[model samples]
Target: MEYEKQTEHKHHHVGYGTLILIWVALIALTSITVTIAGISLGSYTLFVALFIAAIKSSLVINIFMHIKFDEPIFKVFLIVSGFTLIVIFILTFSDFIYRG
Candidate 1:
């Protein structure tokens, strides 16, 4: 019996323009985060910073890290990790709230 040869597939490449755009977006978000930090938003400051950080991280992971083009397992792992982080944050906040 003859075995069939597997063909190599080419992966999609991200253009420099797209990378530059993402870089600019990340810079803008960083600036916004810094500006928000300078102002007194009371208890919402951390939340706002974390929210911006989450966005920046997502962009980096999906684009720069090529997670967007990776397999479904990678995407599933990303979601699971994000969910775990959320749970950890919630538990930490709850502990802080319950502390005397």
Candidate 2:
């Protein structure tokens, strides 16, 4: 028997359990990082904040934005944007580091 595919745009209910867990984990981690930043960590505090922010952004993009299920073109756009951001950061840091 040949099975016919549905042509209409059907909204499949994806289980939110996994997504909830991931979001909760990200929130917990971010809270802990912020709590730690409150302490006297000196210069390392900046690095820690940046790291936490990056992780949170990644979670938002991959899970909430549904980038993981997106097409290759979207992935390529993400990669290009990420690389561009990295290049800009590097250049800015280079200027700061070299400033007399």
Candidate 3:
């Protein structure tokens, strides 16, 4: 019970400065994404967009959602989730490529 209470009271607060920096970085990434979209990178375009989006998502998950400050189990869950998503993407892409 005490352990539960302690865990419940644990709070991770992100600083305003850090949040502002993150916001700025996110905006810059968005701008880059837009600029890239307008270009004809062809085969590499999807990879670039997904890479930037993944970075933005990780930043939001770690800092804004405080996932980094959560319990180890949560981190484990995140890892498993990410792995599953990667596998799914790989399989889907493989099928799309091979079907042609």
The lDDT leader among the candidates is 3
TM-score of each predicted structure versus truth:
0.86, 0.76, 0.86
Residue-by-residue lDDT tens digits, candidate 2, 41-96: 88778778888888888888876776765557888999999999989988998897
Model 1 TM-score relative to the real fold: 0.86
lDDT of 3 by residue, 1-100 (tens): 9856655565435678888999999999999999999999988999999999999999999888878777789899999999999999999999977895
Error of 3 at 7 (Å): 6.4
Q: Model 2 scores what on Cα lDDT?
A: 0.75
Q: Which candidate, 1 or 3, would have the higher TM-score against the true structure?
A: 3
Whole-model lDDT per candidate: 0.86, 0.75, 0.88
After superposition of all CA atoms, the RMSD between model 2 and the true structure is 4.8
lDDT by residue for model 1 (1-100), tens: 1211211121246778899999999999999999999999998999999999999999999888877876679899999999999999999999987999
Stretches of candidate 2 exceeding 4 Å from the true structure: 1-14
lDDT of 2 at 33: 91
Ranking by lDDT: 3, 1, 2
Backbone clashes, each candidate: 0, 0, 0
TM-score-sorted candidate list, best first: 3, 1, 2
